[model samples]
Target chain A: MTITLQEVLPTYFEESRRHQSEIWGKQLTFNKGEYIKIVAPSGSGKSSLTHFLYGLRNEYNGKLLYNGQDLHGYSVEDFARYRKDHVSIVFQDLRLFPEQSVRDNLELKRQLNPYHGPEKITEMAERLGIGSKLSVKSRICSYGEQQRVAIIRALLQPFDFLLLDEPFSHLDDNNSKKAMELMLEEAAARGAGILFADLERIDFFPWQRLYHL
Target chain B: MALSFQPIKPLLQTGTNAASRWFSYIGLGIGVLLLLCSIQMYINIQQLLGGDSPRKDGHDFISISKTITDETMGQLEKNLFTEADIKDLEGKPFVSGVSPLLANNFRFQLSGGSLVPFVTDFFVESLDDTFIDTVPPTFHWQEGDEVVPIIIASDFLEIYNVFAPSYGLPQISESTATNLGLQLICYYPDGNRATFRGRVVALSDRINSIIVPKTFLNWANQRFATTKELRASRLYVKTKDANSPDFLNYLTEKHYKVNKDKTKFGRVKQVLQGIFSGLGIFGLLVVILALMLFSFYLQLMIARSKDNLQLLLMLGYSPNWLSTNVARRFIPVYILVVLFAVAATQLMQWAFHHFAMYDREELTTWLHWSVFATAGFLIALSLFTNYRMVKRLLYRMA
Candidate 1:
């Protein structure tokens, strides 16, 4: 029953799994510093599986385990606490409040971890190349700029794992590559595992392991 | 396994989900309107009741009265005015004028046997001539016998059915105008006859009634002394001193009465009391229902906005923050609704003033304060409901 990261690799999937097919996995695991990439076609249930893992959708008939315990043991408050203190998600739509500023977006993330200082917002803004644009409203920024801010916001929060769902969707090749590099560097510094969902774009940075849904 | 009433989240993705959202807005609107109306009603009632409840004017020294027929005298004793007392108080500025005397409808069965009833109000007099001034000899006494001049009511011509210049009656000619006489065949239920020879001089249009020389009344009484019956109702009065409480007291002690027309006051009071009491009740009902509906809408909106709230909740915002934020959003709407209600009430009062000829004070006072207070109550209700809804939602979610 011991969960390991290697067994969750996409290349190790069975042939019975087809596109739009439902699959169940038990005893799933990720090492503290692992970099895992999951790829599928447009309708291959990659987002669905990601939502399941993030605790956003829980109707599926399967067991989700963490640290050798069933996921049901975690209540909504527990999930919220985990999202605030040990996990963060970068949504596919770059779901930022349009009325807020880039700095505030990141600051909101920092607030999730009560111990995080305000200086982290400035540091993250500089790293995301949005330091000058921090005061700018989110809607006013270009897609690439917004993408960077979203990633930076996700990073500002205290977390041991990052779930990125098509975080590079709107970016051009060069910006996407740069954003991927920055994301990896931030996650690696914190020794957090990064589970990224992507289409068949084939342009993502090399990952330590890949899961095909 | 213990079950929870969790939201069916999967159903929300469809467009049909928007129906509930629109419904929530409608509920909110109704609730707000109810609260506003209730507040308006309460204020109006307070204003009408003279700041608390209904009240009537207390009796005072200058108690005016009216005297009806002797047959109805017992019934009118509680409200009677004496003739001499009325005449004595004629000149007082504070003594508002007595109302014009109401007369019985008189029918003149003409010589042609046509029955015609004419409405008449004539000033009566005794033979004393105390209140009458003699016309100068140059004023041309139109007479044939004793030359007793009689100033007739203008409407006397209408009752006689004799158009002097147009009817072509011989005795009413221009040369004999000074000596024209009226032989009125006065008939009661029994057969009757009367010859009244008097010179008709001037026409009067003073008030809603007609005036006559006091002598003419005496002439009628003397001419039919054995047959004519007379009744005196009231003597129109003006007081020499309006603030003469002593005079009023003296009149009271003498078993005499003074009556001032307070119909205007009574009418104004009744109309105002009626309108404002209804408005207060309506507004109160609206607020109560509105509070309920508003609270319901707030709860529903909280449920609808659950995901957004959850995001914030996950972002380490305290439950109190969500409550404050939700309550703050409704503050402006509540304020606007209340203001609209108050403004509407004032506008309605203004309209009443513009159209109503009677009393504007009653309408104005009720609307001005009623709307304001109601609006305040609605605003507070909205805030309170919003806070409670958000708090409950947060507790449930937790």
Candidate 2:
């Protein structure tokens, strides 16, 4: 499964902004099993790009294609099937059910399209240092803990591509390294690609292909 | 309760206005109860009409005659039933058969012998044997039979018995009267007369005229002077229901008269059936209104959870799958409500049969199979409509 972007630009962005943007109005292809980095400044539509790629928004110029099929033409069932089996995403804002327990949040994802067992969730939580917070409600947990929870939730489903919109922003370097290591192991096991969009480059990880915006 | 649906359960639930749920269940219960009751009552009415009327004669036989008014007095020709009139009356849907009474146009007399010496003027008529309550096999006759068979009205016998005691005459029993023979004398206007022996063959509680066999009447009328026209002054109509408004209305519209006492039961049955039919329609309306109310409740619940639903859809829950889960959640409640209504209808039927109707042999103590089938139909309709409504609402969000 490959995603192709043909001269894509967010419709909300001005023509002047597109001229200064490297990723906009450019034909790009992100293939399966490739770790790609998209680095851009603030107010450069980083989240908009993630939302467009996740199929949450479609109001943009040019085309966003999934395996050569235009995104605009995707039916509702097609989007759900792709989300469950082809792609998964970790939103920048960590959209978790705040009142639900951390364990329940992961259980929901696992049961939707189970690619992992409950023990796998427990094993991941232990490695991320949130094993003790599994019974706690997501809202009462700290922001960094919720971010790790969100990352684990996204990884619970089977996917050929994973979209992370600055997933490690709230984490310290050590926790970020553990989370990234776990994500890479999971992605490598399935031969899935990871698209990490962030503000700047991280020293610990080197990019296979980097898009500077 | 399937684990597959648990992922969207929290987001799709809204529990504040719980009164709507109760109201819908209650309304559905009442609506279904009324519907079933209406059907049972209709069935019961049919059973009563078809059972207890005691129509030993096997059909309602009504004799109809044109009402003679002051203007029609002494105008026998105008009052007689013409061929067109008979054809029109025969064409009525309620009239199963028409048998015109053929009256003797010449003079006839009956003279009793030494046992009960009495003489009376007679006007004999003949009807088709199918309409008579009692027809002996020997009632038919040819040209030269020594004796003719006659059937007198049972009312006429009773009237004679009432007057016989005052006249110092014998009050005869049915068997004694049937064995006696009398002389039937027919006189033509040309001053020639012929006599034949007549025997009592059968008695009729239905037809009022003294009836002889059709063969005998035709032979005697040929020998005696009579008009060529075979018009009927009175006709007996066979009907399915004597008191049906359609039949009675037809009689009234044609200015024909019938005995009202015989139709009193029919009037009561008609009024009862009408009431039950009205109740059935009202019950159907209530069922529709209740379903509509439940639909509104479902809409409100889905609307309250709008934001959460959208988020769940974004989480890869298909609208169809989610709507199916939501609709399935109410299946047990719907089943319970319909079953409760059916049980209630059965109880009402049992009570009506045992207590109100005093265990009438015709009525059953349980609800009809159609009532249960209707309950099943209601459950299916509720599920399907709720499924469609939920699917439509979720599709809008999608």
Please name the candidate that would achieve the greatest lDDT relative to the true structure.
2
The deviation in Å at residue B385 for candidate 1 is 3.4
List the TM-score for candidate 1's chain B.
0.38
Model 2 C-alpha lDDT per residue in residues B119-231, reported as the tens digit of each score: 88888999999988888887888888899999988888888899998978899898877776878889987868888898888888888989999999988887785675666
lDDT for B354 in candidate 1 is 62
List clashing residue pairs in candidate 2.
Answer: none
For every candidate, the chain B TM-score is 0.38, 0.89
Per-model TM-score (chain A alone): 0.82, 0.97
Residue B132 in model 1: lDDT: 20
In the range B23-115, model 1's lDDT, one tens digit per residue, is 544544554454444444444433443311111122121223343446666764334444544455554454534432322222222131112
* Model 1 chain B lDDT-worst window of ten: B51-60
